[model samples]
Target: MDKKLLEVLACPVSHGQLFFHSQTNELFCPASGLAYPIDAGIPVLLEAQARPLTEEEKQA
Candidate 1:
C-alpha cells in the first residue's frame, strides 16, 4: 500500500480517517466500525462492500 494514499484515505460513510491494516489487507474506520477491503491493491470503499468490525478488532 502507498503511504501517501493511506494518509489521505477517509471512510466514505463517516468521513473519518482510515488506518491501514496490512495483515488483513484492509482499511479500518474506528469511528464507523467498518473495514473496507483492498483487492489487488485497489480499495473497495463502498458501504455495501465494507464489513462490520468484530468486537476484538475494534478493541484492538
Candidate 2:
C-alpha cells in the first residue's frame, strides 16, 4: 500500500486513522473495529464493504 495514500485515507465508520496490514492485505481501523479490504490495488473504504475485526485481531 502507498504510505502517502494511507496517510490521507480515513475509516468510513470512525473517521480514524487506518493501519495497513501487509499480511492480510487490508487496512484495519482500531477505533471502529473494522477491516477495510483492498481490491485490485484499490482500497474499498465503503462501510458496507468493510468486515468486522476478529477479537484476536484486535489485540494484535
Candidate 3:
C-alpha cells in the first residue's frame, strides 16, 4: 500500500485508522473489528465486503 493512500484511508464503519495486513492483503479496522479486502491494489471498502476478524486475528 502507498504510504500516502494508507495515511488517508479510514474504516468505512468506524472511520478509524486502518492497519494493513500484508499477508492477507487486507486493511484491518481495530475499532470496527472488520477487515476490508484489497483486490488488485485497490481497497474494497464496502461494509458487505468486510470480514469480521477472528480472536486470533484481533490479537495479532
Candidate 4:
C-alpha cells in the first residue's frame, strides 16, 4: 500500500485513523472496531463492506 494514500484514508464510519495490517492485508480502525479490506491494492472504505473486529483483534 502507498504511504501517501494510507495517510489520507480514514474509516468511512468513524472517520478515524486507519492502521494498515499487513498480516491480514486490511486497514483497521481502532476507534471504530472495524476492518476494511483492500482488494487489488484498493481500499474498500465503505462502512457496509467493513467487518467488525474480533475480541482478540481489539486486544491486540
Any runs in candidate 3 off by more than 4 Å, and if so which?
none
- Backbone clash pairs for candidate 1 read none
Count of clashes in candidate 1:
0
lDDT tens digits, residue span 7-57, model 2: 999998899999999999999999999999999999999999999999999
How far residue 29's Cα lies from its native spot in candidate 3, in Å, is: 0.5
* Deviation in Å, model 3, residue 30 alpha carbon: 0.7
Q: Encode model 4's per-residue lDDT on 1-60: one tens digit a residue.
A: 899998998888889899999999999998999999999999999889999999999889
Residues 1-60 of candidate 3: C-alpha lDDT, one tens digit per residue: 988999999998999999999999999998999999999999999999999999999887
**True lDDT of residue 34, candidate 1:** 99
**Candidate 1: tens digits of C-alpha lDDT, residues 1-60:** 899999998999999999999999999999999999999999999999999999999999
Task: Estimate the lDDT of model 4.
Answer: 0.93
lDDT (Cα, 0-100) at 38 in candidate 3: 93
Candidates ranked, most accurate by lDDT first: 2, 1, 3, 4
Q: What is the C-alpha local distance difference test score of each model?
A: 0.95, 0.96, 0.94, 0.93
